[model samples]
Target: MKLLLTSAGVKNASIRTTLVDLLGKRIEECTALCVPTAAYAMSGGPGAAWRQISGRASTPMSDLGWKSLGVLELTALPSLDADLWVPLVQETDALLVGGGDALYLAHWMRESGLADLFPSLRDTVYLGVSGGSMAMAPQVGEEFVGWKPPAGGDAGLGVVDFAMFPHLDHPDLPENSMADAEQWAAALSVPGYALDDQTALTVVDGAVDVISEGNWRLFTP
Candidate 1:
């Protein structure tokens, strides 16, 4: 699987270039599925999902004009047959997942049977924004935990080995300052990254690279 994990969606030229490289095609040629399940657990969540699906959010996702775009609401997957949705996911060029509650997204991804399919999607791009990206980590850190899963803890899907701290130094989220990221990382058992809106981490074939047009930092524990 190819992962383009960003703090924000395609917010800058550098991140877009990395996305194109992962897709191996223009944005217009790819077919993407927008996963908005996580947003439902967020504040003003329905509105958040609508903005993401309608491409009206600050992020440049659904508005990128893919060949075709669809929504993959994870919450509703449990009631449907796998045959009904598995093929769609397998055929899509990318999964454009937006931000919200990390554990909530992780719970549904696991419960929806999507996380189980990750190993086979070698050619699929997983584009994650904020919570979307954090949900793939082994742990999101206690500070970011919101919608606690039944199993409990800040654990994620472990899709990637490291944890992530997004929106670093974001003016609107003063709590996400560098010092805050440091504190967050100090509690984790693995390495972690703090990325700004203009940065992203691309993972392909187990290799990871940072693609950024803004500041970022790596903290190792």
Candidate 2:
């Protein structure tokens, strides 16, 4: 599957170009599934996360747009039963996983039996934002460093071998966050991509490429 791993959303012009470039003419053709991490729905109801993408409540798939589907309002583990989540993945042409807590999303994907559904998602393009990008990596480092531990290891979906360090230079981050990312990347002995806000890492057929207005540093083991 094709992956559009952005540092953040498609806000900046350069990031938009990156998305459009990777998406090609299929931009509108593909269905975008916006999978919100647990943090996205911490306070609001299930429909709240859905509104972040489509600007409307999470109703039938047809009501959203473009013959596609998006999965929002994913808070608790039990909420992702086959009745609710499976149909969306089965019907969609592609999926866009938004940013939040990467570990939480990974755990939910497994507990809800969603990880087992990957093979069936052959036709789906897997697009991911910050936290989503981290989920595609082999490991995200200290899973419980910032939040409480979920059920599993920091192990990601393993869609890609490289580990991604998102929001490298985010304005809201502490001064040492970037340094911490760099150190983590070095210790892991894996290829690392440092994505500043508005940047992206686009992977297709195992090849990795960088896309952004800002700079992205790559670390090789």
Candidate 3:
């Protein structure tokens, strides 16, 4: 599986280039599945989900011209049989995951059986923005915990061994400052990263690389 984890969705030219590189084809030639599951746990969730699905959000995701686009509502997957969605997921070119509550997304991914499919989706790209990106990390600090999961963890899935602090220094999120990120990383048991809106981390076949046009930092435990 390929991971392009971003603080914001393809927010700059560098990130866009990286995403295309991961796809190994033009965006218009690829099929994508948008995951709006995370948005529902946040404030103005329905509206947020609409914005993401309609490509009305500032992020450059759903609007990107794809050969086809479909919604993969993780919350509803469990109710349906795996035969209904599993085949579709394994065949998709990419997954565009929206941002909101990391733990919430992690919960559904596990409950919906999506997590189990990761090992099988070796050729697919997992494009994650904001909380969607954080959901891939081993943990998220207390500062980023909003919608708590049933298991009651202040974190996310163990998709990656490290943690991440996103939206660093964003004007709208004062709490996501570098200082806050430093403290958050200090408390974590694993290494972590503080990513600005322009930064991203790419992981393929266990090899990790950071690509950024703005700034980011990796802190060790």
Ranking by lDDT: 1, 3, 2
lDDT of 3 by residue, 54-94 (tens): 99987778888989999999989989988999999999999
For lDDT, the strongest prediction is 1
- Which parts of model 1 have CA positions greater than 4 angstroms off? none
**Which 10 consecutive positions of candidate 2 have the poorest summed lDDT?**
57-66
Listed per candidate, the RMSD to the true structure in angstroms reads 0.6, 4.7, 0.9
Please list the C-alpha lDDT of all candidates, in the order they appear: 0.94, 0.64, 0.91
Backbone clashes in model 2, listed as residue pairs: none
Q: Tell me the tens digit of each residue's lDDT in model 2 across 86-188.
A: 7876776666676667776776667667668777676566667667678778777762234435554567778788888877777777642667777877766
Model 3, which residues run further than 4 Å from truth?
none
- Candidate 1, residue 173: Cα displacement in angstroms equals 0.5
Compute the lDDT of residue 107 as modeled in candidate 1: 95
Q: Write the per-residue lDDT of candidate 1 for residues 114-192, one digit (tens) a residue.
A: 9999999999999999999999999999999889889888999999999999999999999999999999999999999
Once fitted onto the true fold, the runs of candidate 2 whose alpha carbons sit more than 4 angstroms away are: 17-26, 40-51, 54-69, 72-85, 148-153, 176-178
What TM-score goes with each of the models?
0.99, 0.76, 0.98
